[model samples]
Target: MEQPFRVCIFCIRTFIHRVLEPPDDVKKLFQDYSQNGTMSMDGLLKFLSKVQGQNNAKEDDAEVIFNSLKHLNIFPRKGLNLEAFYRYLLGDLNTPLSPRVHQDMTAPLAHYFMYTGHNSYLTGNQFSSKSSVRPIKKALQNGVRVIELDLWPARNIKSVVLHGGNNDVEVRHGGTLTTSVKLLKCLRAIKEFAFQVSEYPVVITFEDHLTADLQEKVAKMVTKTFGGMLYRPEIDGLEKLSPESLKKKILISTKPPREYLETQNSNSPHKSEKTSEEQGG
Candidate 1:
């Protein structure tokens, strides 16, 4: 099932409003600190001193802290924007809503443990199950940074997502129960939900079984819908990207080259290799 775009927007807006709205006590504190619709640096220091009463503030330390707040635009040359000040003090206005882990971004991609979602389209059992875009929204909301898509060609339709080995092109579970969702619907859901929970990049792993024409359609839709948010190797380049460099972007991981796959298969250990030479002889 596909959720309306407006519904997604409304949910995001409501969440933002809830987070940014100050509580009654906070509002009263801000009002008490404000003089002429703004709080002066002195007033802010007083409020901070009261909150940190146990730790005595040194003359130079207070000046340095005040300067830092000024640098953050929390305090302007005229005075402090009380609403902005309150939000900053409460740590509610930051994009990620959590402190970022300081890591060496130049490290190889293998070092990171990506938050991944498996078989993201189905809301229930893989066989004889229902498929919906709701799963994508829920995964992203809970911070699943990598999502899977199983794509198949559909007759008289562009494409659909399903899990079945049958040659039939419709979206179904075990070639039995049909799902109403299509490829575009799932793509739309991703676009809507990807960045809501976190500002980090999202990676989509596609398992595609579509004709070249339909694949082109998929590519076009992705580009048109996601626009600058979708990562392009031509612009961003083919080098291994660091987490910092790929922030707020969407990346797609497709099947590797046949040669690479063949090499992997050849290098893989087999049961035959474990057999004793004497037994084989």
Candidate 2:
């Protein structure tokens, strides 16, 4: 039913005419709570606490809600009629998730569900599309926490992030026509928009295809771009890392290059970086 007008537009003084038609069950419920065709404060409080599962709802909460839902200056803060009740059913008041964060923030990173962007560089196709930092910026702006970047050596000595770099010789979409975006541009984009939507940590997962030298360049680029915002674990294992502790931090997620690990193995007697690994929850 499109525009189910309950009252005349010209003669509307009591409540705003409901734009949506209510179902049979909703009408029955509205009538059930109605006393003299008006849902009173006590009725609303009962509906909220019992039917809506707002267990902590009290008299003042009911009054505040009742006052907010009534037709503003058109009606006094007395009760909710069918129109007001229908509006309440369609409004932001009825929600599954809390409007505010109510859970404990002091938990491991893995314990939480984070927004992740897959193939964060590519703008379109997997095989032959131009990769850009715009999508990364959009993802960050939308509160994405995990961003996946496939890092590869550019034609020159610079580094670039792209998709479909599965080929051995060239960093392309396996030999297809996928274009690439510069790593510096992606990092700068991340740095600019990472914390705009949220204060929690942002994880950059690099699908590394660069050589040892390019890896060093990438290290420099990441460090310079993020600066003090980068998260470095104080202890060897990140056992106690939590969302509360890592507020407004950018984190790195990638395996060290084999060339660098081999160099470490040859330089020291112990296995060093190779044998060192930690399990986190």
Clashes of each: 0, 1
Q: In candidate 2, residue 6 scores what lDDT?
A: 41
Off by over 4 Å in 2: 1-18, 21-85, 92-94, 156-175, 258-281
What local lDDT score does residue 154 receive in model 2, on the 0 to 100 scale? Answer: 66
* Tens-digit lDDT string for candidate 2 (1-281): 12233466565344334366788899999888878778888898888877887888888977766666654433345688777787777777676676556789898877899889888877888888888888899999888999998776565433223442322222233345788777777888899999887888999998776687667777777898899999876865456888888999999999975556777678884544454542221
What is the model-wide C-alpha lDDT for candidate 2? Answer: 0.75
Tens-digit lDDT string for candidate 1 (1-281): 12224456345322223336668887788788778768766766677677545245555644554455655534667566665566556553223433446667665455688899887888887766688889889999999999887766665422223533222332323344546467677778999999897877899887765555666677777798799999988664536677767778999888743445666677767734655454777
Task: Output the TM-score of candidate 2.
Answer: 0.58
Model 1's alpha-carbon lDDT is: 0.68
RMSD of each: 13.4, 10.5
Residue ranges of candidate 1 with Cα displaced over 4 Å: 1-108, 155-180, 235-239, 256-281
- In terms of TM-score, the best-performing candidate is 2
